[model samples]
Target: MSVLNTAEIMEILPHRHPFLLIDTVEELESGVRAVAKKAVSFHEPYFAGHFPGNPVMPGVLIIEALAQTGAVAILSQPEWKGKTAYFAGINHAKFKQKVVPGDVLTLETEIIKVKGPIGIGKATAYVDGKIACIAELTFAIG
Candidate 1:
């Protein structure tokens, strides 16, 4: 069990500013599970047009953040380290609540199965202890 900081996250994930949605990983257990966070802010570029008067974090981006967290869990493994994880598919995605600026989204991912370069996981996004989004994501490591 270990906590990974932004520096460590950058080493594993290829995402950068305006796209690197994960702020910090608070918990990690190799291939088993992981938890991370993304602090939503009004300064985000997307907020500008997402709705000028009433900005809201886009649902797709929320799912992407969750998938990115799952990627961290998969890539953190020694054998998968340095590899890139691509979004293979998403299923059973649902947005239960709206995520807005000032929300600290807690992203949780648990590995459901993994075989070779293919991995499947379940992810959930929470804000203020309430689930905002949930999905079953599949990824392919290359």
Candidate 2:
């Protein structure tokens, strides 16, 4: 089911509960790409204030989830181990669908370019095969 569990993902990425959006990594290709999943639940903290009657998973968090997936891809490299990947930029982001509680997001990020400590990944988040969000994420490792 999971190529890398949450515990294993923690070893590669510096993130924790409430903020760690990804549940499990379904596929990994070292520094090239990664596919992860996140199960959205109404019990999430933000749901309390994100809109009383209507709960919607924020688009920003979806992007962050995508970024985390990309981080896993970049940080998995031996040279980048123990390094933190900071967001340099986010470009061409689009939210096509609303992700709500009970939706399981399938996030994928493919490293498209890398130069020195900076890299760019093409990311996409999907819910039940439908695109929820897409973006080009840039990261700077330090």
Clashing pairs for predicted structure model 1, backbone only = none
Model 2 quality (TM-score): 0.99
lDDT of 1 at 81: 83
Q: What is the C-alpha local distance difference test score of each model?
A: 0.92, 0.96
* Tens digit of per-residue lDDT, candidate 2, span 1-142: 8999999999999999989999999999999999999999999999998888999999999999999999999999999999999999999999999999999999999999999999999999999999999999999999
What lDDT is reached at residue 71 by model 1? 90
Which candidate wins on TM-score? 2
lDDT of 1 by residue, 1-142 (tens): 3388888899999999989999999998888888999999999999999999999999999999998899988888899888999999999999999999999999999989999899899999999999999999999999
Candidate 2: clashing pairs of residues: none
For residue 131, what is the lDDT in candidate 2? 98
Model 2: worst 10 consecutive residues (lDDT sum): 44-53
Name the regions of candidate 2 deviating beyond 4 angstroms: none
